[model samples]
Target: MTLRIRSLLEQVPDRLDQERFETWLETSALRIERILSRGHATPAGEWYDQPRDEWVALLQGAARLAIEGQPEELDLAPGDAVLLPAHCRHRVSWTDPDQVSIWLALHFASDGTPQPGP
Candidate 1:
């Protein structure tokens, strides 16, 4: 086997018309991805409800997240992280317009173990 080093903050474009998602790693039990956003937000009345749990960290810039049934949105800055359990509806409410916002997200089975193949 060989080893390679990569930076998460590199290779991003200066402008983006829409958010970008890149899968960094994937296995039967887990998936890790990098998401780039610039002034992006989920459309009104839309939410993401996933079958697996997701843990996300803010690596650059700033953003706000809204979880269904919550009265207030979450404001995230660099180094902040949050975990959304399976079926927990959520959306990106706001992101910095002047700069790119980088997010690292990990998705896994709800029980934190490998899921049976379908």
Candidate 2:
């Protein structure tokens, strides 16, 4: 099969009224996705409780993330990242309104600790 190459920064919609999630790859135990947000926030009183661990990185723009039990919300800029353990309740508190926020997220089995591939 021929190898394919793509750019993440290209082909993004010019405007977003709601957050968008695009899955790039997936397996039985893992998934990789790209998310786009513009002035997006989780609904009031809503939180995400996932069964898998998630590692998310911001590629463009900025955002705020609030986690359950945390006293302060996390402000993330380009290149910033965080790992959320399985079942960790969290939500997007805010995203840049004038610019699109691009994020790369990886989700894997709760116990699939990352290790170097041989």
lDDT of each residue in 64-111, candidate 1, tens digit only: 999999999999999999989899999999999999999999998876
Clashes of each: 0, 0
- Cα-based lDDT at residue 28, candidate 2: 98
CA lDDT, every model vs. true structure: 0.95, 0.93
What 10-residue stretch in candidate 1 is worst by lDDT? 109-118
**1-118, model 2: which lDDT tens digit per residue?**
9999987788888799779999999999899999999999999999999998999999999999999999999999999999998899999999999999999999988655665533
Which residue pairs collide in model 1, if any? none
Tell me the TM-score of model 2.
0.92
As a whole number from 0 to 100, the lDDT of residue 59 in candidate 1 is: 99
RMSD of each: 5.0, 2.7
TM-score, prediction 1: 0.92
| Superposition error at 96 for model 2 (Å) | 0.2
True lDDT of residue 97, candidate 1: 95
